[model samples]
Target: MKRIAIDMDEVMADFTKKHLALFNADYNEAITLEDLQGKKLRDLRPHLVDEIREYLKDPTYFRDLDVMKDAQEVIKELSESFEIYIATAAMHFPSSFTAKYEWLQEHFPFLDDQHFVFCGDKSVIKADYLIDDNVYQLERFTGEGILFTAPHNIHEDRFIRVNSWANVRDYFLK
Candidate 1:
C-alpha cells in the first residue's frame, strides 16, 4: 500500500485556535483568526514572543488541543486504503512528547504504535505522500507533497493545497 504521512499540529490538530486562545487570554485582547492567520505569533506581536514560546513548554498546551474538523474521519478512511503515519516535528518541547502521543492515542486510536514518528527534520521520513501545514517539510520531502492550509502557508503555491480534510479526501479520490 502507498504510505501517506500526516502532520499533527495545524494539519490534524487545531494549533491556530489553541494558540490564539492562549494569546488572547494572556494579552487580554480579542483578536480574530484572520489577524494572525499566515503569520507567526512572534511576527504578529513581538511583545508576546517569549510568552508564546513559553506556552509550548506547558503540557496543557499540547494536551488540550482541539482536533481539526473532519480530520479524524478522513484519516480513518485513508488508513483503510493507504498507510497512515503521523510524522510530526515535536522535539522542541520536552514535555510535548508524551502529551502529543497521548493526544493522538485519544483522538486517533485507529493508528498503530508504529505509525507515530517523532522527529525534528521531516526530510528523513520516507513516504509516498506527505500532508503537512509546513512548507519547509514539503520542500525537503522526496515524495508528493500536499500542503494543508494554515495561516503561515496561505500564499505558498509549491504544492497542491488541501483546505480541509474534505479536500484531502477529494484529492485522493481523483
Candidate 2:
C-alpha cells in the first residue's frame, strides 16, 4: 500500500486561533506565526515562548483544536487506499508529545498508533505522498506534495493546490 504522510496543524487541526489567543494572553501583545518567522522565539517580549511551551505541555489545549472541514471524510477515504500516517511536528515540551498523542486518539479515533509519527522534521519520513499546509515541509518530503491553502498565504503552483478536503480528494482522483 502507498504510504501517505499528513500534517496535523492547520491541515488537520485548527491551531492558529488558539495559538494567537495564547500568545496575546501571555505577552499582552497580539502575535501570529507569520510575525515570528524572521524573529526568534526567545527574543519575543514578555516571554511568549515560555507560555507557548506551557500550552503545549497541557493536553487541554489540544481539546480546543478542531479538525478541518471534511477532514474526517477525506482521511477515511484515503486510508482505505493508502497507508495513512499522521506526521506532526514535535511539541516543545516532552509531556506535550504525550498530550498530542492522547489528543489525536480522542479526536481521530480512526487513526492507529502504528499510523502515527511524531518528529521534529518530516524530511526523514518515507512516504509516497505528503499532504501539508507548510510549503517548506512539502518541499522537504521526498514524495508527491499536496499543498493545503491557508489564510495568510495561498500557494499557487502546478503541484496540487487545494482549499478544502473535497478539492484534495478530487485532485487525487484526477
lDDT of 1 by residue, 72-173 (tens): 998899988999999989888867899899999999998997889999889999999999999889999899999999888888888999999999999986
What is residue 97's positional error in candidate 2, in angstroms?
1.1
TM-score of each: 0.96, 0.77
lDDT score for residue 72 of model 1? 93
Over all chains combined, what TM-score does candidate 1 have?
0.96
Which lDDT value does model 1 have at 64? 73
The parts of candidate 2 lying over 4 Å away from their true place are 24-54, 57-59, 155-159
What lDDT score is found at residue 36 in candidate 1? 62
The candidate that wins on lDDT is 1
Give the lDDT of residue 170 in candidate 1: 94
| Position 23, candidate 1: lDDT | 82
Scored by TM-score, the top model is 1
Candidate 2 colliding pairs: none
Global CA lDDT computed for model 2: 0.76
Q: Deviation in angstroms for 68 in model 1?
A: 0.5
Error of 2 at 121 (Å): 1.2
